[model samples]
Target: MARSISDTGSVVRAVRVWPVAGQPAGLPDSLPEPIAAVAVPPAGPSWPEHRTRFAVEVVGDGASGWHAPVSEAVARLVVDTLADGVVGHDAAAPRKLAYRPRASRHHQGAHARQAVSAVELACWDLASRVSGRTVPELLGGTVRAHVPVYASALGLDPAHPEAVKVAAWISEQGFWGQKWPLTKELLRQGPVAVARVLGNLREAAGEGRFMVDGLRRCRLDEALGLLPVLADLRVAFAEELLEPGGVAWARVRAAGAGVPMAAGEHAVDEHEQTRLLTGGAVDVWQTDPGWSGGLARSLHTVEVAADLGMPTFPHGDRLWAALALAGACCRDKVPAVEWHLTLEPLRQRVFTDPGAVEAGMLPSGPGIGLAPTPVITSPLPVWTVGS
Candidate 1:
């Protein structure tokens, strides 16, 4: 046996940490009882001793890419921070070695963005299988061929029956666009009581065109008094009204507000999404690729909002990594991609290779491009990397 190259780069090539358990593959495992937890760090006493929490089902294939509905202390802090910092590097350089601060010294929360988004999506499915090309042509190709999605309408009280079974599965699931998130007592019952609750959510989105987050909860006179009743209930945009550090956000963009004023989801990188595109407070940028620090910083905020023409909209769990980075971006600045239907069916039932996201596009399929449908009713125990 001849060993060279500095003793095979100083050995260190053994990984097999396991601790699997299952209960999340897709819709209806269970959860709906005033269920709302976000406890990140509390209960002092120097916490860390495997407090035990559970959830999983973020699978992928064509090589590797599965961060399953994480938790179990986010898969043991991503397999103990990738077995102590990315198992000896070069796992295809995982986003240039996990953003190098010495691989963020034992990493941080959200299991360090789900172990750097599951080893940077399995190092981009092993660099699209060594350049055979996929994963959006190694992240800089393809522009369309579908990829539009937008459902995200979690439960809220429209007389809660799970909000009429989540508005009848977002109007019989041919999803295209939808949004929720409006609690501040429903914007303080102003603007004609929020235009009679946007006319009962435009009759539960029958024709579909929803979207009205108001995540920050408004206040520029309550988003200019709910913008002329959400432009007479057309209501398709207005997310995060205002609250991401501002310089008046172009004075809430001249208080026109006929609609369209989305915001970056707690952004903290890409130079704050180029300062929310130089303070226009976003005409639409809703990012959150693991909170602006993954998917190459949400494709560098969709290439700086497609060179300031502004039109990016990603904020929703890894829908195939935001539809494989919005199908290689630049389609008039990324038309859409946001889906949390029934609050993420355990990350959309493990994707066993299949496709269907109607209205708002996303057709194509196969390898690193939509084709999974794993909805295992129950089966858990299979974490691996080493016993």
Candidate 2:
């Protein structure tokens, strides 16, 4: 019965992984330094942007999976990896497959982790579909059915004076928290200008939980100088105030900023998550399963944070997975899921039956255990066309 149930768990019967082609032929021979070199190319109605598809389906048995999750085209690399890997594995035992052994033993880098996240998400979706329960119920049960959200904006137009437009839109959606990235260029404009930006953001968001994500920039002294103004503005929490590292982290922690600090997205492994937690460097432990290995690793990170009595606010992406785990395990400390306000919603929309992200919580259901939405748009092309 267990085997039968596991076998028929996922709605998807089988899947295939295919690499879709980008417009411009081969990517740069050598990746540019400061690897943010891979900027996004524009796509419009005429040119449909394509992502590598792991043509996933639930099959009778003997299925397979592979990698090369990176793409010069799209950033949602995890979707394909998980779709490919989790296709045949008992969606019931997804956590085991997530930590499955590899021959060469690649490190838990972004690609590998993204793969795990995709599979875990799919498994949860399958479980929810099979069981007819929301993912939150599968995990445990929600403390609150709808989670309050904070609008995240590391991708918003910096020069656009109407930057507040997005925040206001989020406010309109009933989100109370709103965050914007702090660029070095903006910071160099000095505290006055920074204050002006903050004032603008607050005016746009009203009495919401406004936040600043520094994106791991700034030195200790620089952060120290900025802390007072941030605290005075009654900012909720200063995220990634200093570049993550032992010395710099220690310096920022020692600065005694009246305001709380949030960090830990850079933690690439379970051990690093533990070190950061033990070091007392971060007030909010933000784990990204797409970077911190996979669901198991992320769960371990959350466990560590929970042990220390801190909240685990995942650093965006794979939010459904994070919220599912949060519901199952650490409820109290899971303050809010970092809703990447601009990007993730589009991915959800592409799904035929995307998971219900109402209020904030990803609804719990059955099978792999979250809402069943066909997140994949289409299968990636196997052969290059018109070349």
Candidate 3:
């Protein structure tokens, strides 16, 4: 049972990680203004059909949640790392707690970063609960009641004809914009094939803005070369055309990909962002609080972007990042947030009321206000932390 939310000292007592079914009970009729068929992309290495998250129920006292677009397991062994850093700490000190894992000498590789991010999200949830506020409200009340959202069609394999149809259908609906992923196969087909798809999507999009996620589908020069074609297609931005921290980013600006270029979704600190932006490699900054070392780091990244006049846009299809960025976007920290059509109602199911959107904007609430409900597709997989 969940303990009462208290203002006094509350410490994380136990942590639970569980897998929830990815498919929604039913597609929500509300979002995208006029509902249309948005194809769910077949599961890929980046996004699978299952949802896994961490929940921290205050042991001695407070609250918490999980994020990431992947379901890589949180090792039972790492509980020690998390315990040493967070188990007994006050829930209110989220930044301090979120950094504890990194502060420890044991941090290693991407898995460690993902582990820390999970705990950090819980900390923010705990902090919000203790303060009787939503994370956004605590960050400072939002700038807009609802942040503008773009439909993320990462689930669709863009090279397929289904993608074109789905793109046309959803574009007819009201959304701030639409983003499609570039698969390895599509990129292998080279610029000619790429142009055809973008052109078709642009026509299908009507007036809706179109964007592309390179997903590292092609070489930097090749990605840059497509700029003129993308410009004609009116693409809003091209994301991750090259590797996140690859040497090629420094040379990207000189190549002048006519359309806007975006990177940094995998970047965790201002230092990383600075090196990427310093060279003018790309025009936009993509930061995901969940992926970029959690809320504190994300805020710091936004401030860093402001210093460089770079627009902040958090990238991902997960709820933790979605809600976190949504709060920040409402506060005007980010111009817009990405809402993966794949996660859709399934992601919202994890929340307590999960709220609703009006005119492409999500309603604000307390503590991110999400709780895991039973997923009917399969038996729930649960992980106990600090056991």
Model 2 bad stretches (over 4 Å): 1-15, 18-89, 131-133, 141-144, 157-172, 329-331, 354-372, 375-387
Q: Each model's TM-score, in the order given? A: 0.32, 0.73, 0.79
Better of 2 and 3 by lDDT: 3
Among all candidates shown, the one with the greatest lDDT: 3
Candidate 3: worst 10 consecutive residues by lDDT?
369-378
For 1-387, candidate 3 gives per-residue lDDT tens digits of: 664434344466666555443443444445442233444434432343243433333343534433322343543323546755566666666546744543357564555655666667666666665556667765656545556677787766676665677676665556678998877787777778888977787787888888988777668767766767777887888888778656775556556647788888776544666677675666788876655666776777777676787777777544445555556553445767777775555556655445444465554333443223223323443445563
- As for TM-score, the candidate ahead, 2 or 3, is 3
Error of 1 at 289 (Å): 3.4
Q: Could you say which candidate leads in TM-score?
A: 3
lDDT of 3 at 259: 72
User: How many Å off is the CA of 315 in candidate 2?
Assistant: 2.5
lDDT tens digits, residue span 285-369, model 1: 7676654556776887778777777788877755666777788885577777876544454444444543445655664234542
Q: What stretches of model 3 exceed 4 Å from their correct place? A: 1-9, 16-41, 44-72, 75-78, 98-104, 159-165, 269-271, 329-332, 346-358, 364-387
